[model samples]
Target: MDTQQNTALTRALAEVPGPLPARGVIHIVIPHTDRFTVVGNHLAQHPGLSTTAVGFAVRIQSLPQGTEIGVKALAARFPEGEKLIAAALRELEAIGYLQRARTRLPDGRIVTRTVFCNQPSALLRLPKAAPHQPATPQAPAPAPTPRPVPALPFPLQPIPELEPTLQPVQVLTTAPQSVPAPAPKPEPLPPLATTPECAPAPPPQQPAAPRFVPLVPPPTAPKLPPRPLPQPCELTPELHRAATALLADLRRHTPEFTLTEVDIQQLAPAVAAWLEREARPDTIRHVLTNDPPQPLRHPAKLLRHRLTVLLPPPLPGAHDLAVPVRRVTVTPFQTCDGCERAFRSSMPGRCRDCRTDHAQAAA
Candidate 1:
């Protein structure tokens, strides 16, 4: 069917007297009323702008205000990827057809606002026109010689030359010049004074002393004193027994953390301080015996250091008191295009209800 249609189209086109198909593009204009964009010839036929950029500009201009024309949005809607669309947008921006401004929201989010201009020249100034000058009168050009006609079967008569017409020349008149004024006579010079007046000379400046900058290193900040180890709480029989058992059991989990009885008595106070802060036995055991340094030297000192550094602060207020957790909804507020109402949406468009209603109506 397509082949037959093509053959018929070719036959009809051959019979008609019109421009050749290979010569150039033939435009078939269709007037649009419902949806249309008025593009300037300067942008449509721009020598510098690429085809993608020109098309992108037209698409943007046709879109209603507040419509999403972002790179990602356009890439999703069109076949071209984000990179090509971004390049086209940049091209349009460079030519003053598109402008993007970053705006920060009250919620600490930054968004880009785009403004499209159909006529860039209206926004940017154009070059001024050159001042008009009167045209100089030029002599008429001579006519070209007639070409000889080919010999025909019958004899032809010789043609006669017509004489050129004489035109009257208008002589130009020059404007009169104004008379020159006479020069005034020179005045006599005054007599010269015997003594000349002179300005006083400035006082001689003394050379500044060559001061030397000492090559001293920059002042360093004072080192902070190491944090003091947690003070041992008052020893109790139960606390002493529990602390001793915890220290003795450390070697079961990690052999490197083995401590002697003398070391246990010495470090027991530090563990008691941790227990006073309400740290759990499991947490304390995990801190000491979970991961010990290789070739352990001074297990008691390592235990003492961990107890001091990893001590937890006492609970504030009543232990039974409950603290409320704050939940922040980070969704951005969007103005619905249909209802013109503000609503929280990750993307811009109609609100949920409006969208549902529209979908039902369409269905």
Candidate 2:
């Protein structure tokens, strides 16, 4: 009886409809309270927009005004390359979700200004046809027809109630009033005999204050700090030439290191100081050319700093004064006692192969 009851319960459960089983790509959505972007289905599910374009539109619409939405900035934040991001931005622009206009600023700089539209359909909608008006008897003066106002692309907020404007209305009266006679004008008396002493002299006019003008200097490139000068030292013609060549050739390693002729001349003396301290040319080159700042605005200043700061001290002792000499030792060739092969050795001995063979034989 218990088994039958259990079977009946199982049958009833199967017959009852419950929650459907989870399927592919189930989403658990959480309601947002703050710091969220509102995206519309028109953009998210646009048939003409590609996936990248749709995503860009959604992100741009959610962003606050003045936020950077340039292709390079987006590429840096996302995994897509600049080319792909630019293409997506173009697609969004074509679909009316994005607009780019070149605006000239007060400072005389021409920049691209971007405007994002969440509801483009409003602007794209056609103007409604004018309402038909019945022909009435023509009057001498006809009122001008009002033009239709175009729809704004952005959503409109509810307008607050305003106080009604008061208009002046003229009132008419139908009453007869008695008229009064106008008084005659008084006769002008003869000009009083004015003596020069009785009449006051015209007041003297004071001179206007000098106009104050503010002197503003014209805009110019910022002055870079002067390149540091190296300590005074006896510069030789050879060292001077080598230093100049090193400074001039820096452009080969990195174009940013390119310096003007005047810059090279000014910086040459510093490089000469490095040479005077027994610094190798290669070391000097590396110090000056290694990891220069990008978009180098002042190459001379940078080289100057490196030259003065990184200049190595003169070699200790009298070694720096003496000429550097490199000595090489040669090993004499010898015949292997066992294999009769010629091999280089410091002292007469068996070659490596003969030694291994002799050791194996002894073992």
Candidate 3:
């Protein structure tokens, strides 16, 4: 049945409505072996490469050999802008897929050349060795020798001048006055005798007694232990479990790929952000497992992209509404309660002058 339809279509094409130009058509062939390398090389495994970069690389591969392509031209050809195209070119260069070299021409002008490599092994080729030339014979130069500097035979000594004898000048001194001796203290009076004649003798005074007081120690309060520091939100057990699950899911999709705890740590913030936006683990798992619009050579990058772009809107909650609304009261003028003087204040209260005066009076 398919053969009959093909025969009818061939007969219909034989009767053309218009003439077709043969010179306008051109044909080119891309080898299947190079296609595999472009799609599966170490450059393709880079997590930093976006889908736009991969498309850019594909378009570059489709171009003819030794064709000059500018970033702006490529950007115009593709949907991505010039900035992204330039970034893709940079990524390609970094991953050894592309190389650029600038050469100065004999005309004093500089020109840049782009070298594209499909295979990874081509990037590791050693540079060619320069040709060897015969050496010319020449006399060897004499070695330089150092000459010692002469030292003085004896250390130079400084000369001293002779001392001259001089007559001493007579010095006048004042006579010191002698200090007078202090007078002796008077002798104490004798104690009075207990006699009836002495005002009938005063009643024997009672001996003053010393008061005894008890000492009491003040009570001491017990010391409390210091509070522990709060840990980061990423290091929490729930987030760790979520990150482990995410890595496990990625491994399921690409068994050859492996992620370390450091990667998980880096990705924790994005995961936490998604969770904060009320995204569920199952929903995230579904999004990750579903078929992507384009081929994903780097799962971590794709996961990050999806997590960021597909984040749910924040849900209304009591905590969000509980934020205290700052109330601002505007007043043209106010009077002090104590002094009754007109002043300016947001809320009606005592003026600063009156308050200071009151504080001073209280103090």
Candidate 4:
């Protein structure tokens, strides 16, 4: 049908209650809103399921008294137009119209239904309708006037009692009685005149007693004997000799060597020996990602790694792990130096843990 005739038929059909088959195109538009472009485009895309234009005029014709165009039923109108239906409904929602969709099962029976407000799933505001003066509904009368609201005339009848029971009525009564007045009391005579001479007031209150302060003694920590001073051992003499020799060799040329446990054992066995001498089986402490940054804790092998390793210039030339030497951080994890987290991360340059050493030194 031509757009004008089709629209008229839709308008005519909207005034009455009846079902219309879904043609190849159903254009449901909100009337007075002039949002037909979106619906028209949507309907053009879907050539499978039949559809008819629906607008304010169409809506008025489709809905009967005390009835609404249910979305569930609307969905059922186009059995094969599910995809286009949402687009159609979304157009209606964008124009501030609600939608109801209905479905039929494969066995040719009504099944699922969905009633949705004209809303975007993401919760966008629906466009509001412009000001519209609705047509005044008219009714045929003696002089052609709107039909009056019919009175709901309930016949005058006595109310029936629900069950055999007596309702109690409560009433209040008053009892009047007069109380006797008390007898008047007599006024007492004034005391005889006293002497006019005034004795000097007692001296002002004595000054407040001096406050007594309680003294508190300082807390005394238990005095434990100081740890014995480590004495220079025969091994220490040997260590001094070895250290002096190594220092002398390093002076000749830059030194680079791996100091493994065996190497350390061979050289500075004195410190290890001392540690072994003092080692207690239960004195073990679990180490996490804590690296000893102090030169004193630097093993000979790690120093050698640095000597062999040519780090990327701390300059911003290259990306990735390049960082200011000040920012580079290394922590000890496991028992190896090569192991790192799955994702490469720079170690913190300075550790806050050493702050306690500073505090102790200040004290």
Candidate 5:
């Protein structure tokens, strides 16, 4: 049938209010069969089945077989509309009330076939199996006899005899004997020899002539002066222009403040530092003017402070001018006279080992 005919049939079946149905009403017949009651009860009691889904199921059942039920048509009939109708259709498909399958046509095109089953048995019934050859019947096994559980043994008896009482035994008491200490032995006095007066006179002869030793001073190392700090680089013309523009913009934003040449020079280094860090002039201007917690009385000072705080550290110089290089004299290694080992020393004659040995020998 054509679209117009189908629409007319649907409208006739619906019996919608208009000029036609004022006195009499048209009705769509829904079968009162066991299958219908089972399906309806199943859908009504289903926890997952929504009201819209139940309505859709009822409408689907009321409609004649082979009637094209599009989502749009079902949505127009149902209060929940298209999304709900689509969901309802999916629910029905999931629970076996409705089923859809894709079939390839002769023209190499695919089409979907949807089947609606009102009766639960139609969808739930199992297929019949193939017939098997008859076999001889076997005798049933004999029933097993239930054995009674054994009774537990009588409660354990208490011991008849009591333990013997412990008795105290008498212990003898004796006085401890004191031991006597040994006496100390007396020390003997050393014998004195007589001195001869003739031998004492020879000892007074010349306490040898006093010898003079030269004093040696300790070696001192030369001290190096501290390094000087590197000077900041000069600002280029581009940097100067950027700084001037930034200041002019800031002045415009804060009309109460004035930027002088001295202020500009003082702040130029900060601006140059920011520029070196790859921050654009516009970005710096935005940061300075966009949000000020309080009124900026000294715009130049604030800008300088911000630039200084945010500025990246300076790059390393190719050649550091502050640190001066000094010539260092290296002593040649000489073999020690005592240990026969090579060692570097400031003194030319002997190594430290040999010198320590000679000093010990003299001592």
Candidate 6:
């Protein structure tokens, strides 16, 4: 648990005698000769480790009392499994952590505890030292600081003398300022239709010029005319017919009614009429559906359920009763959205007419 202990374990592993490891997929087997058990681990869990987490698990195996410890606890404590138990288990199993044959319960039955891994736990391996290297150095201790002396208990330090101040004076005088004239301004004009015309104004006297110039128009392409916007109440023949059919069905169902609300019975035709009359659609939220907003299926995936006899429950009283009776097994049925009733298969995902009706309504 302490740094020194961890260091000692690392040194012990490093100092142990061992053969040189081969490059890539190194398979190591540490003999369980007793004092320290060998641990083997996946290279991945201990990326730079010479020994693996499985190797550590094997080392723990030498403890006589905890030999039958759960794979889960062992997986947690060991180096290889510490980082990733699932990945460690996979590698260990591949490397042969399991010796006992593994078995399974029938479908719907609980799994048992006794497991010899189909995969091995990464075994404990001896840590390796560099061949012929000097011993590792120990860290030195830090030195302590000395205490400071106390200041004089009571006498106040002597105060210093102060310096002189200067006198003030004032004098008088007066004056005022004038602003420059602004340039001549142009008179504002009123709107062409509202204001009356003035008698043609005389041209202002001009400064002398040497020459006069002629004016000319710049080049440009002809402009295209703008298109007119469409108005509401433009309906296609098909949309009108659908709306008509829907309204007729409503008339048959109720004689006296105001068409203010929209449901499946009301919304479909009303939405159609709104679309036909106006270019824009009425809000989709107006159609009231309690259906979930997400896709009903995990896109493109199919259900693959296994039906097995082991999953069945026993007949009540028959197991202890003398009289013989047949046992029946029951599974809940899936349902159809269109009819709010149970059915054997829901393959189409929605009720049969849902596809056609939804498309038309959405459009």
TM-scores for all candidates: the values are 0.29, 0.30, 0.25, 0.14, 0.26, 0.18
Model 3 C-alpha lDDT per residue in residues 6-40, reported as the tens digit of each score: 99767765665566457765333335764443355
Which of candidates 5 and 6 is the stronger one according to lDDT?
A: 5
Residue pairs clashing in model 1 are none
Estimate candidate 5's RMSD in Å: 39.7
Better of 3 and 5 by lDDT: 5
Clashing residue pairs, backbone N/CA/C < 3 A, model 3 = none
Give stretches of model 1 more than 4 Å off: 1-22, 105-109, 125-363
Candidate order by TM-score, decreasing, is 2, 1, 5, 3, 6, 4
Ranking by lDDT: 2, 1, 5, 3, 6, 4
Q: What number of clashing residue pairs does each candidate have, in the order they appear? A: 0, 0, 0, 19, 0, 28
Tens digit of per-residue lDDT, candidate 6, span 28-83: 34556757733334433545332454454454455565354445776655544444
Better of 1 and 2 by TM-score: 2
In terms of TM-score, which candidate is strongest?
2
Q: What is the C-alpha lDDT of each candidate?
A: 0.71, 0.72, 0.59, 0.38, 0.60, 0.39
TM-score, cand. 6: 0.18
lDDT of 1 by residue, 1-363 (tens): 999999977776666566767776654444687766778899999998999999988888888888999999999888998999999998887777777789999999999887777876654354444333323222234323423232234433332222221111112324334323333432222111111234234355454432322122224747667556566567788887888898898888777887888998878888888887778888999987767777788787777778878888876776457677698979999999998999998999999999899999999
**TM-score comparison, 2 vs 5, better candidate:** 2
Q: Which 10 consecutive residues of model 6 have the lowest summed lDDT? A: 299-308
RMSD per model, one decimal: 34.2, 33.5, 37.5, 36.7, 39.7, 41.4
**lDDT at position 114, candidate 4:** 33
| lDDT, residue 338, candidate 3 | 88
Runs in model 2 deviating more than 4 A are: 1-28, 125-363
